[model samples]
Target: MLPLSYAIRNLLRSKSRLAQTVGGSALVVLLVMAAVAINQGMSRVLSASGSPNNVILLGTGSEESVQRSEVSENTTGIASASIPGIQEILGVRAVSGEIHFMNYISSDDGSRAQALIRGVSPAILHVHPEVRLTQGRFPAAGEVMVGRLAWRNLGLKQDRLKIGTSITLNDQTLRVVGRFAAPGTVMESEIWAAIGDIRVVAQRETISCVVIRLEDPEDFSEVDLFAKQRLDLELSALRESDYYGRLSEFFSPLRAMIWITVSLIALGAVFGGIHTLYAAFASRVREMGTLQAIGFGRTTLLLSLLQESTLACLTGTLLASTLAMLLLDGLTVPFSIGTFSIEINSTVALIGILSGLLLGIIGVIPPAIRCLKPALPTALRS
Candidate 1:
């Protein structure tokens, strides 16, 4: 058996090859970690955005997208009275009629970007308990409240969305009165204003949806029955969680594209690493033959080679993990619906480490076997 020092020394024999192996592995592992982070971040935000105890009443044909749904403004009042199992705080029922509008908003500096805007009343707080004001207070008649992460979606800086600042929406200027946060949810990337203000700006007589919070999740059937009985309202009842879950499914193709892109890139890097390892081992054939003639088994030589390759790949894994933590962790990324923060938690890190180990093992076998295949006498002649 070769000493551990033998594998270590062989790795340093060619600094260029060592660097190539390490760099290749690092790039592949980093890509995998990034893909995992993106998919996890998007999924986490969507799932957390909805509450099981809540139901969304959308216009019958627009159940898939709240922004596209339009219900009569009077439905909010009617549902509040008709829904029997609804939660109540004091005399007020936990129901909110909201308007969701997505359009270009302009900063004070004249830069415009698309943002998800929500129009709500104070009753929204009762329905969505997760939202809390982090700075200033909720919006008044002509003012707006920005989410702590809304700046990212607007392509602006933090200072741009600060309280007292102003933004242009639908050619109407509105003051920024506060910042709110709904942690781990897409709501953190939205802009909120008074329902009347948005209704005027969006030029719609109807609201997007009416969200109601039930005392118990099991009471959903009662609400569903109401929607079914009221044929004139043209309403559809859906659990809030199920709504967001369907959104996740709707984005399946985008996630699949991400995985496909990462897989293709990683495959190329793996082949390149294998070729480099094979060439490096091919040049060391005579040395392996000499060791074989000295009573060292071919299996031992193969194991030593694997040890060297694994060491380099594992080092790259460490490098990739560090880079991902520094660059990707907690980074906010915006999409059509909202923004999510990439978090390289323990699970993502573990997957990255395992990917590195696989690269080490899979990348070495073919090259290692071929180099150690020749008989001791024939190999020495070469």
Candidate 2:
């Protein structure tokens, strides 16, 4: 077998070509990572936002979005009293009367951006155990608890959403008295305010929806029965998980487009890498023949050449992975409903590395074969 040093020396032989190969490989690897992050991040956000045992009651026509839903203030009482399997937390019914509002909010720095604000009673926390207040307390009237990514989705910096920072909601100025984290979920891109305060400020007299947690997820039929039986209320019931699943389906096309775009560009890079490898190996035919004559054989030389390509690809992937960790991990991307942090976790990194290694092997094959196609005499003479 050819010494591994020979492959390393060949890569070091042409600095310019090596740089081109490595740079191209890095860009392709980065594109693949970005695609994975976007797909997985969106998937995670949707999945984290829902629990199967939870049920949402909204206006009949507004089942698709809570923002458009308007349910009766009495709906919570009706469901909590009538639903047989409702979960009770500390003797309090796990029912949240929430008002969802979206409007342009101005940060303390006077920067304005669109924001999703949730008006909720204290029971919201009881309903959603995932929300943990990292700083300050839950919001009161004239105050708001910013979700960790709320400011980012609003295009404001982290400092603008911190405790004591104030933001304008229409003509009203609401202080950010707290910060909460609901990791991997859309709730992390919302501002929580007291239900009464938002109703007064947003000029809405009706609650948006009533969220109910069930002791048995399968007991959804009871909630459905309530919504069905109450014709005057004009209500509909949806499982929280199914709602987010539909949301995920809605974003599928967008994610597909990202993958398609990345794939096309990566294909171009693959072909370009092939051309580069062909040129690099073609120039080393005489060197390869010398190795073959020394009992290394064509297979040994081919493996050595493959090792060079894989080394360059692996190095480029490492660089791309580093860049992704620094710039993309924890980066918040705002979507239709809210924002989700791009989690560059192990699964994503592993997929990216495997993609790069596969690209290296696949891209090297034709070029490697082409370089060895000629007779030993012909190759050595070239």
Candidate 3:
């Protein structure tokens, strides 16, 4: 068998080719990590946002999107009175009727930006325990509480939405009272205001959805039955978690697009590496012939080729892991309704390393097989 040191020494023979393969491998791994990070980030946010014990009441035929759903002002009272397994907080049923609006908000500097606004009552805090104010007080009528990442969602600077800033909504000036955060959830990118205020400013007479927390998760059947009996309101019951999960599925095409685009670029890089490996192996045919003459098996040469290619790929993996950790780890990106942190954790790193090794094997095997298929005398003479 050829010594592993032979494979290592052969790589140093052409520093330029070594550098090219290493650099190209690193770029391909980096693209893969970026794509994985995006999909993982979106999934994390959606998964963290829901509780199985919670059920949403939306208008029938609008289960796909809450923004398009409309529940009547009397829906909340009817649900609280009719539902049997609703969670109660200090004698108050954990039922919240909210008005969800997406509209252009005029900032302090007179610039308009689109934002997701949720109009809620004081019971919101009781219903959604994940949301907590980090600064100042909760928003009241004529006031709005901006999410911590709302500025990014609005494409504006943080100072523009900070506490004490004034925003205009339909000619009405609303003051920023606080900033809240719901970590690992899309709630961190919304603005909360009083329901009456939203109704007055947005000029909408309808409630978007009713969010209800059940005492027992298994009580979803009761909620479903209630929705079915209420044919008058034309309402449907959906689990809160399932709603966000569906939203995640709706964005799946984006993840697919990312993979397709990055895979093509990585494929090009793999082809480039294959070319480099072919030339490097072709240049060493005389050496291979001499090794064969000295009683080394052809399999030894093939294994040595694998060893050399893997080392180059592993070097690139090291570089890519470092860059991903420094840049993508914990990096926050805004989405349609909220923001999520790109998580480059241990699993993602492991996947990236394995992908790099796979690329190396795929790029090297065909060229190695081709180079070793010649007659011994022909290889020696060439």
Best by lDDT: 1
**Poorest stretch of ten by lDDT in candidate 2:** 287-296
TM-score of each model, in listed order? 0.97, 0.92, 0.97
Q: What is the C-alpha lDDT of each candidate?
A: 0.93, 0.88, 0.90
What would the per-residue lDDT of candidate 2 be over residues 303-332, giving only the tens digit for each residue? 988998998888889989999999999888
lDDT of 3 by residue, 202-301 (tens): 6878899999999899999999999999999999999999999999999999889999999999989999999989888888888888888888888988
lDDT of 2 at 332: 80
Query: For model 2, which pairs clash?
Result: none
Q: Which stretches of candidate 3 lie over 4 Å from their true place?
A: none
- Over 4 Å off, model 2: 289-297
lDDT of 2 at 360: 80
Error of 1 at 318 (Å): 0.3
* Candidate 1 positional error at 334, Å: 1.2
Candidate 1, superposed: residue stretches over 4 Å from native: none
Q: Give the number of colliding residue pairs in candidate 1.
A: 0
lDDT of 1: 0.93
Q: Model 1: which ten-residue window has the lowest total lDDT?
A: 373-382
